[model samples]
Target: MIFDPSPIELPSSYEKVETTGHVFVSHYPPGTPAVTPVVIVTLNRPAKHNAFTPQMVRDFEKLFPMFDVDERVKVVVLTGAGKTFCAGADLEIGFGVGKDRTADHRDGGGRVALAIHRCRKPTIVAMQGSAVGVGMTMTLPAIIRIGYEKGKYGFVFGRRGIVLESCSSYFLPRLVGHSNASYLVSTGGVFPPTSKHFGDLFNEILPDASQVLPRALELATEIAENVSPASSYLNRALMWRDTGSAEAAHLIESRVINHMFGSEDQKEGVAAFFEKRKPNFKANLDDNPPPSVPWWTEIDTGRSPKAKGPSKL
Candidate 1:
């Protein structure tokens, strides 16, 4: 079941560049068109240990669609920019509080999770430092996980007074076992990746930080080289979705769609999609959505997707 890859040329669509804002964005890396293109997404906030802010999550939500529809983009690579993969959320400033879940999600309500699960192309989490809070949840949906020898993974929601928003509570237990999931969830402490957990959870572990991405890329390319383009992604998606929290995903989407329905952006989106044109959103979503008095309230599902276990999140 394990694949080892030989280096190959990256397709033209795959380009690695630094954005004007100094963000390192690797786009459409090889494997997408051939097997599953490796789309590398690095958290740009190294100063904050790549702590996922609500804005960052929102950007992710926006960026996700770019890859989702790109048939050339099959596999995805999620990592951080600096020493720490992600040190959880920025506690002092507050993250994910009163944030718009619709704007913060890759597909707005576990759509990313479901896409990751059902992606015919594979996903790999290259963790070299701490992956906490939403950071941890973000990678839970990946098919392959690689942690550096010194890397520490933590789950800190209990200490922070936040419930697992990324639905890690439902997915992590399945990945690492119930007991291990319990210890991390209850304590909000860091745990070294053990063989029992990592062996089952991570596809590989490297000796140093430098080796993590290389090894992941190697594995990605190997899979890309051998598998048929169509079959590789379809198979990967099927395998991943099978392990996801379907109910959790459904709840997420239901909430997001409800929120969107009230927004002018939703109107733009529907008209645009129907007309085969780009949407012109009226709101400045990059600044984050307005806070709701009832943070946990759900909107009426007058026109929501029917809930099916696996088909949901």
Candidate 2:
């Protein structure tokens, strides 16, 4: 059955967004113009080092799309509330606790990772003190990652007698190469900020944890102020999705160029350059998207049950 996604309702201020429990959603750089704002999602379980639970995983999955569909939000910054970012999953509750596995079930961390991966706006993660296992793996799907120089990261799934979760098998190698990924997964050792591997994981490392969020907000502000919302969303989608080949990318580029050539935003961008003023981008994803936008189709997972087979000899 075909169903439409429910509309997202954003609060007037960051303080008004209902957090429910461990996850807090808010806006960054308060007092900024509403045209293009930066939203922040903070993991608020500081007492437990912001350790994730199944509920936190579900909250993250729901929050990404909420901010993505909101026209006012241009970027999303994910961070932790306290000194440490996340110390991985909460061991007290245990993983896979109450889940029924009679049929195929998706990993909880994978759900959150995929949500961030599929977000239309730019997603940035700010890592603080220590991030291990699912904590480190979940951030792999973000577009940009920033952390402290003294931060610690680990992929300890091997030590726990389990495989990596959050689809890290697919994303880890892509970010840090196959050899590095293999070594990290197999060893399950912690990488300190000074380690070469740690440097590879983060885009930039600040002096300490306190600087991570500030740096992230600065970058988000730059993106929100200067770029067009529709262009940013489409650009992110094209890069993340597999275009198959160079020719496929070329075709997409041509289609986008053709659609944007005579767009209102394009004309204003040019005029602003000549006039030496900030360009007012009135085009948005909901209202004035380009004609060739939404170039990809959703994959359908429905299928018939497996047929019975004869016994093998």
Candidate 3:
């Protein structure tokens, strides 16, 4: 499917990033019962198969955070131009080659991974074509991923003579399982989405690349309309980073549920159910977050040992 290149209304800062031409950004027009402004972000490097680069890293750093904080953006949908999603890093250019100590040099893929991970807005990635190495690992941070059944996927770092970047060491195992993660990384071989080794990594694998983005948009529109943004983000955070014990989890959830029970969204949800109508949930994560978020010990995204918060977000 050909993606429309025309731009949508955006904040000044986000508009600047869109103007860079590294990535395409637009707000999707929602279908019936869905809300407006579901943002679509596409990698614009079809000529290069959307290869990862430092400039791409910098663009995502600026782009996703803007999506997270902007009230107009309901969900972020990611895809690539042309038939190929991403071909991994452009090895010809190499990676970060600074004189800075190994300790100081951050993985470009990891930096973008964390930006997607930490963004309050939920993300859905449409892997319309093959994704390898950094292309595969970096997208692990997204909440949902839809892939083309014909496309190849891999954890190819072992073959590349480098360890996993993009914190895939953590996300890969948790996403699939330790054993499945082991098999994929150990082989460092590309496999189709139907490969059993992939397990649960892909939420859905469509038979055609043309179906990828449309299916993703359908899901995004449903989320934008019927779901509470604050609830969606908090639920994922609770799953990925939870409290110490069952007791703590219960308490945390109880506090959050109590807040939700009285929230405007709660009322709207119930009313919509009774009226057989779609809900118009307006709770933004920035403005209507549940209490005691970031309750887990915070590791610095910089990979520092220091702890920052077990406090409210």
Candidate 4:
């Protein structure tokens, strides 16, 4: 099935915010009960194969926050404007190379990754073509990835004489397993999404690139329309943040369940089921959210240990 871009209406909150340049941000029309509201972020540099640049990194960092804070937004979809999703960082500008050697200097790609990771709304990345180096790693933090059979991805930092950025070290192992992550990063081999070694990295692969964004949008709509905003946001946090410990997971789950049991959205959900109609949910992130929402305020992904002070023998 072919997918056509729908007319977009920017929420009142985003009217003052600039929504142009290397990234294009737009939201699906509101009042569509059958389809959930979704915001799309497209990498706009097609001439250079949508290569990652310092400016693009900055644009991405600013883009996610707008959706994260907007109550009208329930899901976000990321994709490239052209055939390629991203050809990785631009080498001509000496990407990831800097004169500053101080401890405060941060990797541009890492900033983008962290922004996506910490975003409250669920995100989906549509990998249409080549996604290598920063391209592949930046996507690690997103909730889902849809790629086509021909799509290419690689952790090519080793071949480029650099190490991985975008916190892939933490997310890759968890998504694909330690052994696979090590092999991919160490060898820096380019591989298709279908490679058995990659496991379930791509949630679903399509016959061609044309189908990727459509499928991603379809999933986003499902989440937005069917799932409760507060529940979806908190549940995402539960799975992504607290999965490390069973006890931690139980504690958060219990709190969420207890809080949501008699909540407005929960009641509406049951009533909608029995009444055989689409329930109009009154609960939203901006207003009347369950008290247990925002279960964790701060993300403490610690920084690398600072250099030791000069020592005397």
Report how far off residue 259 is in candidate 2 (Å).
1.3
lDDT of 4 by residue, 1-313 (tens): 3243332333354323474477766555433332226877788889888888888777776666555555567788989988999988888778544666867677888888987876677889988888899989888888899987987888999999989788888889989998899999999999989997688898988988888988999999887778777777777777776546788778778887888899898999999899997766657454555566566554444321211221111
Arranged by TM-score, best first:
3, 2, 4, 1
lDDT per residue (tens digit) for residues 149-240 in model 2: 78788899988887898989888987888888888889999887566655477888888678899999888888877887777777777776
Give the Å error, residue 15, model 4: 8.7
Better of 1 and 4 by TM-score: 4
Error of 3 at 295 (Å): 0.7
Error of 2 at 200 (Å): 3.9
Model-by-model lDDT, in order?
0.57, 0.76, 0.80, 0.76
2 or 3, greater by TM-score: 3
TM-score of each: 0.61, 0.87, 0.87, 0.84
Compared with the true structure, what per-residue lDDT tens digits does model 1 show for residues 141-208? 77788887677877778887866656576688878789977777788886666535433666676778
Show model 3 residue runs off by greater than 4 Å.
1-19, 30-36, 302-313
**Comparing candidate 1 with candidate 4, which one achieves the higher lDDT?**
4
Candidate 3 lDDT score at position 192: 96
| Number of the top-ranking candidate, with lDDT as the measure | 3
Q: How far out, in Å, is residue 221 in model 1?
A: 1.1
